[model samples]
Structures are given as structure tokens and as C-alpha cells.
Target: MRITRIETFLVPPRWLFVRIETDNGIVGWGEPVVEGRSETVRTAVEQLAELLLGKDPLRIEDHWQVMTKGSFYRGGPILASAVSGLDQALWDIAGKHLGVPVHQLLGGHVRDRIRMYGWVGGDEPAEIADSICAQLDVGLTAVKMNASGRMHPIGSVGEIDGVVERVAAARDVLGPHRDVAVDFHGRFTLANARRVAPLLEPLRPFFIEEPVVPENSHLIGQLTRSTSIPVATGERLYSRQEFLPVLQAGIAVAQPDLSHAGGITEVRKIASLAEIFDVQLAPHCPLGPLALAACLQVGFATPNYLIQEQSIGIHYNQGAEVLDYVLDKTPLKFVNGHIERLTGPGLGIEIDEQAVRSADKNGHAWRSPLWRHDDGSYAEW
Candidate 1:
């Protein structure tokens, strides 16, 4: 069957969803968002759709290569994310056509259910402890939290103490068996990363995410060698080439977002590359149902998979929830801190077309907030 139509929706709480239709009536959904820049990615997908119309829906690899590299200027967040959503849809169609899940198409499942982790939010010690307990009540075995709210570039001793205290609080709630990971969100500098990574070492966090930004990945080896705590990154690294250096540098985990890092086609390759270095795959998914579904497909097939991150009750969701437009929440139901493998074909979840069409009419213009340092210098958001 040939691809017939490609439609995009900018829904509430900062999300962009893409729907691909084929002549034989099978359709696939994808999340091709760059977090805040939904409209720009939408335009990029629209431009790419011109070349995709009337093409074979099953030519996934060929379509991926052409959509990503066919353009003169290619492979940034916008183009990569646009290509990512389409790639997901293409894979979904292929899986449905073959009457198997996407993981089976990748190869086959290496294990049963993959372990998942949730996010808990709060600043104060009591609040943070309460949030962790709340997640545990829902059967999550592990939880992640921001190391600190807003950080100074060269932070004071008080800031450093606050980071340690928050982690200690989380560890206290998690006890010895449960896990907690801290997301630095690329706010820490190399020196600060060195200081904090070691301090959190005693607490034994599952991992420290984005100790430094992807741009400063050259410093990763130094940071990794310095801290006993496992260093996890790559949420911002979009290509296999980008992941190579850090992998060689001894990063403990690779957290590529399926939606931003060239979708299933490229992330599988990145996972293979990371596997050679003995690194684990903990996909960075903090978006919608389709993105989480895509991450699950990869996790099920990949042998080096560690844990999965979903956006179920993440603070980012405002008016809409993660399962808001999903017709069947059974596929994503979390139990005992793990989501069972999806048995349905394609991305393995059904999208509510009516809800999507309705949300699209009142589409959102969502953007991440900009933060500034006390000196008025720009800070990473």
C-alpha cells in the first residue's frame, strides 16, 4: 500500500503528534516533537511529506535515509525530529502489515517486561520524601528527580549542600533496595559535576543524568573516571556519531530519546554501538503515548536495555495527561514498576482519532520557559 496522507497535531501541554495514512486504510501515529518547538517540526514534516506521498509505505529504511539526508541542510533537532516521527509511523505500518510488534521486526524479544521508573517532584525534604512514597504506592520500584531546581554556573557551597541533601532525602525514602536517579539537566559544569557526582556516590544513585551538556561531552571521560557514580547521558546527542566519543569515554548509560535521535532506525544502531562499550540503554522519553510506545519497542528488542522513562504523571503535563488521547491504556499500564511488553502490532497502542482531531482544533503553542542567572546571564532551561 502507498502512503496517502500525513497530518500533524499540536496538542495541549506542549506535544506534537503525526498521523500517517496509507491507501489500504492502515494508519500509524508518531510523536515528532522537539519539546518546545512543535510548529517548526510540523512545518519540517509537511515539507518532507511532499516527497513521501504515493510512495510505498513499507520502504522504511529507504524513506528514512532520504528524508534525513535528501535535504542539503539536515540533521538538527527540527529535521531529525521531523524525520523521527515519520520513521516511527513507517515502522508502525511495517509491524502492522507483518502482524507483529515492532520489536519482533527489529529481531525478537530478548526478555520479558522491561523495568520502568517514574519522576517525583518537590524541593523541600518532606515534600520530596512524600512524592517518592506516592510513586511507591503506585508500584514503581524506582523514581528520578531533579538534583536541584535552578543552579548557578559556579554555585556556592549552599547550592552544593542542597544538591547533596535532596539526594540524601530521596535515598532515605528509597531505602537500600529501591533506586533513585538524579537529572542534572546539563546544569552542572565539569568542576561542579566532579564535586556533586562524588557526593552522591555514597547515596548510590542509579545514575546521574547529563552531568554536562552534549556539547561538552569531550569532558565526559574525565568526569566518568573521577566519579564512582555511573554517568548517564545522550538525551541531546542525536546521532550514532555523536554517541561514539562518550561511549569510548566510558559513559555508563546512553539515554537517547527515540523521537529526537532519528527514531527506531537510528537509535537501534546507537544501542548496538553502545553495547560494544558495555553501556546500558535507558531511553529518555518524557513526552506522549506514541513516544513512550516507541521507546518500549526498542527496549524489548535491545539486549543492553536497562530501564525505560515514561511521562505518565510528569510535571510537564498541564491540561492533558500522557494517556489523554490513547484509546487503550491497557498497553501502557504500569505494574510493579514495569510495563509489560506490548503484544499488539505496530507501536502497540491505539490512538483516539476523535480526541486528536478535537485537540488539534484548539492546538497549543507550548514553549519551555527561559531562565536567567542572578546576573541576568542566560541559563539553560
Candidate 2:
């Protein structure tokens, strides 16, 4: 069947969803957002759709290469994210046509279910112990939180002590068995990363995310040598070529987002490349249902897969949540901190098209916050 229509929706809580329609009446859903820049990605998808109309819906790889490389200049958050959403929809269509889940198309599942983790304590840390305890009470085995609210290029020891205290509180609540990861959120500098890294070492975190930024690969090697904790990054990275240095640098985990990092087609390759270096896969997904579903499909197929990051009750979602626009949330059923393998065809979860159409009318224009320090200088938020 041929692709007939491409539609996009900018919904609440800073999300953009894409739907691909085919002549045979089978449709597929995808999330191709760049967090705050939903509208820009939407326009990118619309422009790409001009070339995609009347093409074979099942030619996912060809379409992927064309949609991405078909342009002379390509691969960044906006263009790649637009291509990412389209790639997801193409895979979803192909899976439905074959009467199997996307994982099956990727060579089937290696395990039963993939463990998932959720965010707590918002962007900063406060009442985090209660949040940890609440998730633990719900039978979640893993949770991740931000390490600090904001910071300077060189932070004070008192600031480091505050982070240590927060982690200590989480460790106390988590006891010794559960896994806890901290996202530095690229707020820490190499100097600060070194200082904070060793302090959190005794707590034995599951990992420390973006100890610095991906731009600081050399510094990552430096920090990892100083600390025993596993170093995880790559949420902002867009390609396998970009990830080679991260893997070669001895990064413990690769956290590529299926939605942002070229969707299923490219992330599977990224997972394979990471596996060769003995790096684990812990997809970074803090968006909506389609993005989470896409990550799950990859998680099931990748052998070195670790826990998946989800945004079920994340601080980013103010009004609309993951289960908001879906018809059946059962496919995403989280139990005992893990979501079972999706059995349904395509991305496994069906969207409420009517709900989507309605939400599209409300059509949001969401952007992330821009933070600044007391000196009126910019600080990562």
C-alpha cells in the first residue's frame, strides 16, 4: 500500500505526534519531538511529507535514507527529529502489514519484558525522599532524579554537600537493593563533575548521567577514571558517528532516545555499536506514548539493554500525560517496575484518532524554560 497522508499534532505538555496514513487504511503513530521545539519539528515533518506522498509505506529503510539524506544538508535536532517521527511511523506501518510487532521486524525479542524507570523531584531536588518512597511502594525497582537545580562553572563545596545529602536521602529510602541514577543534566562542569563524582561513589549509584556534556568526551574519560560509578550520556547526541567517541571513551551506558536519534532504524545500529564496546543500552525517553513505545521495541531487541527511562509522571507533563491521548493504555501497562513486551502489531499501542484530532485543535506550542543565574549569566536548566 502507498502512503496517502502525513499529519502532525502539537499537544499539551510539550509534545508533538505524527500519524502516517496509507491507502490500505492501516495507519501508524510516531513521536518526533525535540522537547521544547515541537512546532519547528512539526514544520520539518510537513516539508518532508511533500516528498513522501504516494510512496510505498513499507519501504522504511529507503524512505529513511531518502527523508534524511535526500536533503543535501541534514541531521540535527529539528531535521533529525522530523525524520525520526517519520521513521517511527514507517516502521509502525511495516509491522502492522507483517502482522507482528516492530521488534519482530528487528529480529524478534531476546527477553520477555524490559525494566523501566521514572523521574521524580522535578528539575531540582526537594521532598525527593518522599517521591522515591512512593515509587518504591508501587513496586518500582528503579528511579532517576536531577542532581542539582543550577550551578556555576566552579561550584562551592557546600553545593557539592547538598547533592551528596540528596543522594544519601534517596539511598536511605531505596535501601541497598534498588537502583538509583542521577542526571547531572549537563549542569556540572568537568571540575565539578570530578568533585561530585567521587562523593556520590560511596552511595553506589546505578549511574551518573551526562557527568559533563557529550561535547566533553575527553573529560568523560577523565571523570570515569576518577570515579567508580558508571557514566551514562548520549541523550542529546544524534548519530552513531557521534557516539563512537563516547563508546571508545569507556562510557558505561548509552542513552539514545529512539524519538530523537533517528528512530528505530538508526538507534538499533547505535545499540549494536555500543554492544561491541560492552556498553549497556538505557534509552532516554521522556516524552509521550509513541516515543516510549518506540524505545520499548528497541529495548526488547537489543541484548545489552538496561533499564528504560519513561515520563509517566515526570515533572515536564503539566496537564497531559503519556496515557492522555491513547485509546488503550494497556499496552504500556507497567507492573513491578517493568513493562511487558507489546504483543500487538506495529508499535503495539493504538491511538485514539478522534482524541488526537481534538487535541490537535488545541494544538500546543510548548518550549522549555530558559534559566539565568543571579549574575544575569546563562545557566543550564
Candidate 3:
């Protein structure tokens, strides 16, 4: 069927949703946002719609190649995220048209269920234990927390101790059976990460995420070698080419965000590339339901898949939540820390069109938080 209409919705709590409608009465939805820069990515999506309007909806690869290479000045968060959402919509359409799930089209399921992890706010160490316990109350066996908020470039003894204390608190609550992953969140410099990673090694964290920002990925190998903790990154890295260096840098887990890293089309290839390095796939998804569903589709089909990062009760969802826009929450629910295979077509979860339209009426202007050190200089948040 030919794509007849394309629409984007700026929903609450910082999310951008795109809907693609085909002439034969089928509609597919995708989330294409760059967290705080939804409007810019929305504009990019509108522009990319020009390439897909009146074209075959199932030609996902051709559309991907053109949307990515169609512009000479290509490949950044804005463009990659734009292509990501549209790519998700195209794959959704393909699955619906073929009457199968997206993972089936990708070569069927590799596992019956996918493991998932939830977020627990660790910016404040006081709440780390309580937040992790709250996640456990909801049946999540694993949880991820930030290493620190607005950490000093060269952390003091206190800052390093605080990071350890926070993780220790989480580990105390989770005990030995459950898992805890620490997120550096691009807030640490290479030196600080190197110093702090070793301390967390005693706790045996599931992984240390984004030990350094994407720009400093060249130094990640050193961090990985110095510590026994598994290193995971790629939430900021946007393509297979961009991920190649980090994969070669000796990461043990690759955390590509389906919403940011060229959607399923490119992330599947990224997973394959990481497989050659003997790394595990743990798709980073802290957005909305569509993004999570897309990640699950890939996770169920990918052989090296480790775990999935979802934002169900994440602190980011202020005015909305992951299940708010879905018609059926069954497909998205977690069972014993794992999400059972999704059987529905496309992304599997049917979005509430009415709820989405209503939410878009009062769209949000969410922006990332700005942080500064005690001396009033800039700091990562």
C-alpha cells in the first residue's frame, strides 16, 4: 500500500510520536525524538515525509538509504532521530501488511521472552535504596541508577565515596540475586570514570553504562581494560559506523537506543557488528511505549540480546507514562522481570489514537536540565 499521510505528535513528558497511514486503511506509529529536542526532530520528520509520501510503505531499506544518504550533510542526532522514527513507522507498516510481527520479518524469534530493567533515581543517594525497592515491588529483577548528578570533572574523595555509597545502598537492597547497573550518563571524565569504576567492581555491577560520553569513546577501551565490570555504551552513538569504534574499543555490552540509533533498521546491524566482538545487546530505551516496543522486537529476535532498558515509572515521565497511550497494556507488561513475546503485528502495542491526539493538543516543551559546579562553571547533567 502507498503511504498517503504522515503526522507527528508532541506529547507530554518529552516525547515525539509519528504516525504513518497507508491507502489501504492501515496505520503505523513510531517514536522519533531526541529527548529534549523534539521540535527540531519533528521538523526533520516533516521534511523526511517528503521522501515517503505517495511511495510504497514496505520498502523500508530503500527509504532508509535515501533518508540517510539523501542529504550530503548527514548524520547527527537530529537527522538520525528523524530517520529513526520514520524507519520505525515503515517497519510497523511492513509487519502489519504481512500480518506478522516485526521480529518475525527480521527472521523470527530467538527467545521466548526478553529480560528488562527499570530506572531508579540515584542522583540523590538517600533515595537510592528506596527507589530500587520500589522497582522490585513492581516485579523488576534488575534496575539501573545514575552514578551521580553534576559530578566534578576531577571528583573529590567525598564525590567518589558518594558514588560508591549510592551503589552499595542499591546492592544492599537488591542483594546478590538481583542485578544493578550503574549509569555514568556522560557526566564523568575519563580520569574520574577510571577511578570510580574500580571501586564499583567489588559490588559486581551488571555493567557500567556510558563510562564516558560519546566524544571520549576513544578512551573507553582503557577504562574497560582497567576494570572487570562490563562496559556498556551507544545511547549517544547514532549509527553502525559510529558504533564500530566503540565496539572495537572492547565494550562487553552495546546499548544502542532504537529511537536514536537509526531505529531497528540500523540497530539490528549494530547488534550483528557487536556480535563479532562477543558483546551482548541491551537496547537503551528511556522514552515512550513505541520506542520500548521497537526495542523488544529487536531483543526477541537478536541472539546475543542481554536485557532491555525501559522507562515505565522512570522519573522523566512527569505528566504521562508508557502505558498511557496504549490501547492494551498486556503486550508491554513485565512478567517476573521479563516481557513475554509480543504476538500482535507491527510494533505489537496498539497506541491509543484518541489519547495521543488529545495529549498533542497540550504538547509539552520539555528540555534537559542544566547543571553547574559549585564554582558556577558548566557541568554535565
Ranking by lDDT: 3, 1, 2
Candidate 2, 248-337: lDDT as tens digits:
988999998888899999999999999999999999999899999999998888899999998888778887889988888888987888
Report lDDT (CA) for all predictions.
0.91, 0.88, 0.93
> Which stretches of candidate 3 lie above 4 Å from their native place?
none
**Candidate 3 lDDT tens digits, 1-381:** 799999999999899999999999999999999999999999999999999999998889999999999988999999999999999999999999989999999999999999889999886666987898788888999999999888999999999999999999999999999999999999999999999988998999999999898998999999988999999999999999998998888999998899999999999999999999999999899999999999999988999999999999888999999999999999988899999999999989899999999999999999999988989999998
Compute the lDDT of residue 304 as modeled in candidate 1. 96
- Using Cα atoms with residue i matched to residue i, what is each candidate's TM-score against the true structure? 0.99, 0.98, 0.99
TM-score of 1: 0.99
Of 1 and 2, the candidate ranking higher by lDDT = 1
Candidate 1: the clashing residue pairs are none
Clashes of 1: 0
Please rank every candidate by TM-score, starting with the best: 3, 1, 2
Candidate 2 C-alpha RMSD relative to the actual structure: 1.3
Taking all chains together, the TM-score of candidate 3 against the true structure is: 0.99
